[model samples]
Target: MSTPLKRPYRRRNVAKLLARLHPKGITEPFAGGRSTAPERETALDIAGALGAAGQAGPAQRLAIHVLCLRWWPGLFEGPSRVVGYRSVAPTAPPPSMSRSMRCVAPCTPKPALARVPVERPAETAAFRALADLIGSRLAIRIERDRAAQDADLIRHLAAWVHGDARPNTSAAKGVADECLHDDLAARVLAPTFLASWARAVIAEYRNPNHCPSCHGYGERLQLTAVAGSRARVDVASCDHCIGQGVMPWSKKRRAQQLVIGEHPFRQYLNAYHEGALALLRELEHRGAILLLRHLGSDLAMDTE
Candidate 1:
């Protein structure tokens, strides 16, 4: 075919074309690097050079198609000689866009002794939800309670019941007190809900909540932060002496400090007696640790 006539660069399309094709490939156009004007200008310059040379054919058609698609992907694709441009080799096969399957090893089996025991429908739900939540949130496995003796429906149900129920209060004292073993008391005192106050207290005792910053863990905490900052990056100071690292109450011994005046209970109460009493009563009814904490302060004051 005779050298194709050179075509004028459409100033309007120059930018549009450059946007569609530059740095020449299927990569995304510069998100923020070079401005659209410069890219379009470059594209126009290239187009002008091409027209001067001659109309592009099969191979050249492919190049033009690629360049065009690079910028304006909306353009149609087909084999044909239109204007002075030719289509590239049939259409190269579309790139594979399939993603590979993710590989995850199956969980290891748990020992009979380490499994969690749960019984009853509610318990079963709790165990399953706990297990799944632990796996997702804590990135850890919570084995079935090991004490479960069977795998049958009855057995699984029993296991769920056991798992859902709170550990007996006797568990803390170690020896089961026959005198204190009234079934009514046990039922009344048993913890009832997940994330309940009882559960929070138990969890704190089991693992103790820790500060992500400064490795401080437990009830007492010292907080440290830059003076001007709103504590975005503050770290927990050692719970002792507000970051002194020496626990002020430690020297006095928690028991000794419990003697009322030795601690803040009486002083706090004298200053806010009704409020303190109301809070204490509320906390006691809730079975929270407030009694132990406040009673200690009260007794310490007496000793002083």
Candidate 2:
């Protein structure tokens, strides 16, 4: 069979969007990259335009699908804090489209995370929703998938609850606490809904590389120009920052994180200490000494 025809560079809007969203140079996808919102929104808008123009092709379909965020951003957006994007192969390419290149996100301008938290409208809204869900008769069930996330979420949630439920309270707790709470509902969600806040915490603590630039995986996307036959999308890695996630330092920016005592993570952990101690005490109260051996080893090994 003959290969599919490639769009000419003059009309390669999808190609441009793909490149903008793809990693460039030698870095990775990051959440706060300057072009992230613009590129993503443009892709969706252009894809819609293509569909309206009656463009029928696999390339258009794949492009549109990639840009379409899940309908319920509020649901998964929370837990995704601890859990990064699931590793799914890029949506299968159309038979007509041949792979050409891959690049990280460095080509796009990145904002400095010097002393403030970036405003993520979608995530902020979700946290607000969670605050409301916590105390009312309303219920929203979400899963906590990983062990590390479980611990992290608990810490952030503890800070969130105690911070009086204000929006963008990262300065106080290193977590966004923008929720309207019901005391009973909060007690119900402490263990389960905590994962979503992990992302908020990460946004605050990310090092320079993972700072306002990365797509959270330490890389970005780059698109190769549409050439003779096919254009390619590449994923690139950040050479500046070695970490895959959060960091405690940033040499490039000459900025240092707040000391442990003043930092949000420290406060968040402290907030959770109360819940932890209470749970341990309750376990001790029940005389479940055998179970306490492993779980209660931290506060003390008093398995009596």
Candidate 3:
């Protein structure tokens, strides 16, 4: 019989196959049997894990890309499959889970207040400071875009207000009113300065009202997360207000005055609404962030 052909070297075989398989050769090093390049690893890991978990979706993939790219430069460096993340198969519930899990209630968060009431002195003071800080930050951020003479002034004010050089806590105490409103208007050219001015004007002029829905007690309409499904929501009436839209109050005459609804307060309401819209615009432009942006809750302004 003819002698058997000499077997190829194991290393040579691997090298040849790898060369053909990866014409560019191994550009990135391997880590724990996987490629070290984050883009490659993430593409594989996300596809595998999400596919296995059965939650993969176009939006999820895009979200993952957005999330990963914040820290992982490799992910957004070059074009890759993740760029077409939408093309992945539509996600569906995993086949392995029991039916009970599928029918489980969606998860949700419980609402804190049963009813919302008029703003208190302490709360209003906090709000004013926060609004000022936001307006100042926006003013500074916008100053870079235009060559306004007030740009430097805006930058200085923003830095002092937002940075560690802010007004002393002792000085800020009892100085919470719109005392600085004129200062902001005079020194800052940013759009939020107008918003701050409007807020100050509203605070000065608006007649405070207890929330019609929550009553002045600041409690109305309880909200609780669904038992299991976090995404679902459940709402109930405030036990204190009893859903009647009124709460116990000793100042019956003042409450009646509020119910009578004076016109000046109405003007304040309109102005504050405009101010809110302006603040929202500032957020849209990425100049500032509202508390709701961080907590994902509206507890701060439950009065409306």
lDDT (CA) per prediction: 0.30, 0.34, 0.35
Count the clashes in each prediction. 34, 34, 18
Clashes of 1: 34
lDDT of 2 by residue, 10-50 (tens): 12222233333332522323222343233324445533453
Q: Ten-residue segment with the worst summed lDDT in candidate 3?
A: 8-17
TM-scores of the models, in the order given = 0.15, 0.20, 0.17
lDDT of 3 by residue, 1-304 (tens): 5423222111111112222223343222211123233322223433343233224444344333322222122323333222222223334533454567646844433333333233322323434444465455445543433334245445545656888576454433323331223443344454544455434433322223334564432333344666676643334455655543333223333223334233423322233334443443333222111211222223323412
Best by TM-score: 2
TM-score of model 3 vs. true structure:
0.17
Ranking by TM-score: 2, 3, 1
Off by more than 4 A, model 1 = 1-17, 20-43, 50-56, 77-304
Compared with the true structure, what per-residue lDDT tens digits does model 1 show for residues 36-108? 3443234455555434322534434333333332233334333333244332343345343324422242343
Q: Evaluate residue 119 in candidate 1 and report its C-alpha lDDT on the 0 to 100 scale.
A: 29
What's the alpha carbon RMSD for model 1?
34.1
